[model samples]
Target: MEIVQIFGFALVTLVFAVTLRQQKPEMALIVSLVAGAVIFLLMLRKIGAVVNVFNDLAARANVNLVYLGVVLKIVGIAYIADFGAQICRDAGEGALGAKIEFAAKILILVLAVPVVLAVLDTLMRIIE
Candidate 1:
C-alpha cells in the first residue's frame, strides 16, 4: 500500500515535470529536485532503524565500532554522491554528474584503503 502511494506520487511528479519542461524549464527542474529529495527523505526514515540494529549487533558481539563507522561512512558517501549526481543530471548537467560519481569512487577507494591493507596483511601472515 505504501509502495503504491509512492509510485503514485512519483508518477504525478514525472508528469508535472514533463509538462512544465518546455514552457518553464526552471520549474521543471525544481519539481524534479523536490521529488528526488522527498523520496530520499522517505527512504532515510527506514535507514535510522537499520543503523540502530547494526550498532546493537556490534555491541553484542563486542566488536570494535570503528569498522562499523567506516562502513556506514562509505555507504553515506555513496548515497550522497548518487543524490548529487542525480540532481545534476536532472538539471541537464550529465558531465557534472559523471564527475561527481568519479570523485565519489575515488573517495570510496581512499577510505577503503585501510581495510584493504589490513586484509592483505592478514593474508600474508596466513601464507607465512
Candidate 2:
C-alpha cells in the first residue's frame, strides 16, 4: 500500500513535470514540490512507526527518555529544515535555502547540548 502510494506520486510528478515543461515552467516547480510533500506525508506514518519502535526499545534498555525525545526533536528539525530548503530552492532562492540548512544544523547542535552535558557528567563520575 505504501509502495503504491509512493509510485503513484512519482508517476504523477513525472507526468506533471513533462507536461508543464513547455507550457508553464513555474507550475512544474510547484507540481514537483507538491509531489514531494505528498510523498513525505505518506511516509510520515512510517516515521511514527519507527519512532514507536525506538520508544519500546529505549524502555527495555532503560535508556533516558529525555535523550530519545531530543533525538526525535532533532530528526523533526532536520526534516522540516530540508522541506523548507527544498521549497526555497524550487523558488530559485538557493542562497536562502543554504542558510536554512545552516540554521537547522545549529539548532540541532543546540538541542544536543543537554545530552552532551549528561554524557560528560557520566564520564566524570566514572573517572572519579
Candidate 3:
C-alpha cells in the first residue's frame, strides 16, 4: 500500500514535470519540489514506526536514550538536508545545493563532537 502511494506520487510528479516544461519552467521546478515534500510527508508514518522499533531495540540493549535521540536527530537532519539540496539542484541551483550539503556536514560534525569527546575520555581512562 505504501509502495503504491509512492509510485502514484512519482507518476503524477513526472506528468506534471513534463506538462510544466513547455508552459512555465519555474512552475515545473516548484511542482517537483512540492511533490517531493508530499512524498516525504506520506512516508512520515513509516519513519515513526521505524523510530519506535529503534527505541525498543535501544531499551533492550540498555543503550543511553540520549545517544539514541542524538543519532535519530542526526538522521533527520541528513534526510532534510538531502531533500533540500536535491530540490535546489532540480531548480538548477547546483552551487546553492552544494553549499547546503557543506552546511549539513558541518552541523553533523558539531552535533557529534560531544560523543567523540566522550569516547576519547573513555579511552584515556582505560589507558590511565
* Predicted candidate 3 versus true structure: per-residue lDDT over 1-128, tens digit per residue: 77897898799889989898899988887888888889899889999999999999999999988888888988988998998899888888999999999999998998898888888999999999
Task: Report the Cα lDDT for candidate 3.
Answer: 0.90
Candidate 2 stretches with Cα past 4 Å from truth are: 1-8
Clashes per model (N, Cα, C within 3 A): 0, 0, 0
**Superposed Cα deviation of residue 37, candidate 1 (Å):** 0.7
Model 1's lDDT to the true fold?
0.92
Q: What is the TM-score of candidate 1?
A: 0.89
Task: Write down the TM-score for model 2.
Answer: 0.88
**Which pairs clash in model 2?**
none
The estimated TM-scores of all candidates read: 0.89, 0.88, 0.90
User: Candidate 2 on 42-86: residue-level lDDT in tens?
Assistant: 889999999999999999999989999999999999999999998
Q: What's the lDDT for all of these models?
A: 0.92, 0.92, 0.90
Model 3 regions more than 4 Å off: none
Output the number of the TM-score-best candidate: 3
